[model samples]
Target: MKQIFAFMPTFLLSVIFCNAQKLTATDVNSPEVTVVVDIKVNPQFKSEVKSLVPELSALTIKEAGALSYNYYLSPDGNKILIIEQYKSLSAFQEHGKNLFSGPLGQKFRSSFTVNSIVVAGGNLPDSVGNFTVMKSIGGFNSKCE
Candidate 1:
């Protein structure tokens, strides 16, 4: 039992590291774009924000260029991190336009205050608003089975 306990952390780390994927040259050269957004939910509107995520995700995924759209909430439920991936920069721009203009967008705006945004994998237009831009150095993504 003691021997098993001593090996647990090493075993777990090896399992995790072995499963990790690395980006290939082809992946790096692709026109894919990724965006991560951080927001703070208004205390009074936490429930409203939670309710909106499903609908927002559904609509976002239906876009032809959408690769993935997901949201993660902090343990206290006051913070949200949104990760979005698109086939190309144009696709991401189109999605952005729709996100800030529709009824859903109106509801979303009232629910949270955007804290910051980080864009990676492509050059973005100035019209997209303030954001930190980053180039992919090394990363990996596994395709859905």
Candidate 2:
């Protein structure tokens, strides 16, 4: 009984130490800037915008430190939302300059009658607290876990 007790403590201590020493990547990069841009295109620009999306996506994904670059269309299909992320401020600036004078940019400018273009740098806010957790799942009652 004494030997078993002694072995149990040692095993428990080893497990605790192993779990406590779990290390994560220290070099992971966070979003340098999150650009939430709203672009309104003229009704006639729809075809042009659709044609250019693939080219724009390819160019953006190839850029250095490009994290997430996605564009979404609104319900009316006339408004566009662009969310872009970069690893650092310098990468973002370089991309911005390159994009403005690059072929894709020219195409975009010529195609769309932009109602507004808003570019700002910030991180997206967390919404964990806004979510509700259901206590239990039941019949006819929707439960979220």
Candidate 3:
């Protein structure tokens, strides 16, 4: 028992060291930042935001070096989650420069209180369970058929 106890610490330390080294490598190879935007829309602007979803979708899809672009509306319809991944910092910079410069972007921006926005995982609800119940309740309609 004593031998096992003494060896466990060493084993744990070795494992942690290996993980730290792996994280360093990952940091070096990964993008400068991965932005998770948690946009809280005022109750009055809920419909306005929904109306611009198509334009927002188009803008994000047109971005170069975009890895994953996902937007989700909160169950209460007062907040939005925007998860956008980029290959590099420059890609994000380019996205920002064009986002507010185009007509589509301008129109989309006109509908929001930007200051109300918060970072994802900040002042948000618990994430342990499925945040969207509609996923399970989906497919009731036969639009495809």
Candidate 4:
């Protein structure tokens, strides 16, 4: 109806304004940090990669200060995206140290090739090596119950 169409723009504008406020109100200094890792599983190691995922996720989720550790596999199953969130930057650094040192790390390295790593939120203490870092300007992260 004409009446519904006339009110649609106002409704949309209000929604946009509310979203803008949420972004602008975000705390850039929040200590939480999230890392997204993109990797391609080697053809020969596809089965190995699949097997390693559960073990790796279990260990990671048990680590201190780990907020969440999740992996997403592409439809073709050749690529994987890992999303990890930490309570703080220190926690993230500790996880990296642990991950790059042991037998698990070696097995992981042999299974997949890291294509890219993107870090978001918090101030990084040192360079992330080959990673692309993104600072939070305006955004919000929802906490799930």
Candidate 5:
């Protein structure tokens, strides 16, 4: 009983220190940044919009800096979630150029009722808003076979 209480404080301290140290050490080195987009489309547009996911992803992945671009449909079928990863800030910026200014991106915009974006990374882009940024902890990103 006494030993358990004594170890609790030590355990907590270790956990805090380990997490802090880990965040400090590698957060800057984590160059991969991601954009998560949540889209709610008018029901009439749902089927048409869903069909375009592969097209968008395919074009995005062909770019030099895109690590991955995937879109998922919510079970209820009204919402779409797009997860896009890039190798660096510059890559993300390059994506931003197409996202608003290009024809394919216009198609993406025309499909959704509401499009909310959240950028997550060690460093957030200054030009974008509405982000849920975070320091990297630890994880591995592997390509799907």
Candidate 6:
């Protein structure tokens, strides 16, 4: 799998990763787990945040067990949306550890406020405060097939 991704250009990788967010599995661990995080950023630091997006995203999708990880700016340019999908809960946790302990995580803590965290795939705690939960009914992505 690593070799398959190895030959693709970085931008193409990003497109694939971003598109994978909308796909689903028929069962838990089949389609994998996903986390949609909404990050709130003020106008001042938007460029700084955007500057780091591509590098950060490239690093993430290359990691073992990483299915998807990408960021988007809201229409107003004040909000950041991170769409993450992992092959398993463990993979998601691995990404989380890297996220909080790595440079990107540090930058995020100092520069942005977390607006929301939502879980999908029935893996862990469902409704905690502002979180929304989702279960995959059915879907298909040619890339996954």
C-alpha RMSD for every candidate = 5.8, 17.4, 17.7, 8.1, 10.7, 8.5
What TM-score would candidate 1 get against the native?
0.75
The TM-score, computed over Cα atoms with residue i paired to residue i, of candidate 6 is 0.67
Top model by TM-score, which number?
Answer: 4
What is the total number of backbone clashes in candidate 2?
Answer: 0
Which tens-of-lDDT digit does each residue in 28-140 have in candidate 2? 23335545566777677776776788888888888887888888887677888887777765676677777888877877776665554333333323321232212211122
Model 2: lowest-lDDT 10 consecutive positions: 132-141
TM-scores vs. true structure, each candidate = 0.75, 0.56, 0.54, 0.76, 0.67, 0.67
Clashing pairs in 6: none
Model 6 lDDT vs. the true structure?
0.74
Residues 1-145 of candidate 6: C-alpha lDDT, one tens digit per residue = 9866776786586677665555544554464788899988866677788777876787687779788787888778888888998877678778778878878887778778888887787445545345677766555553432
Q: After superposition, which runs of candidate 3 have C-alpha atoms over 4 Å from their true positions?
A: 1-28, 115-145
Reference-based TM-score, model 4 = 0.76
- Cα displacement (angstroms), candidate 4, residue 24, comes to 10
**lDDT per model, in order?**
0.81, 0.62, 0.57, 0.82, 0.73, 0.74
Q: What are the runs in model 6 whose C-alpha is more than 4 Å off?
A: 1-25, 28-31, 122-132, 137-145
Cα RMSD, model 6: 8.5
Residues 1-145 of candidate 5 have per-residue lDDT tens digits of: 9889989998887767664432223454577788888889777677787678767777777779998888888878889888888988679779878666878777766788656777777665455555555555555542212
Error of 1 at 53 (Å): 0.3
lDDT of 4 by residue, 1-145 (tens): 9989999998887776664432335677888888999999989898777789987877687788899998999979899999999988788888888887878888889999999998888566446667788888776654322
* Candidate 4 error regions (>4 Å): 1-25
- Model 3: per-residue Cα lDDT at residue 47: 76
Candidates 4 and 6 compared by lDDT, better number: 4
Q: After superposition, how far is residue 29 of candidate 1 from its true place, in Å?
A: 3.1
* lDDT, residue 59, candidate 1: 78
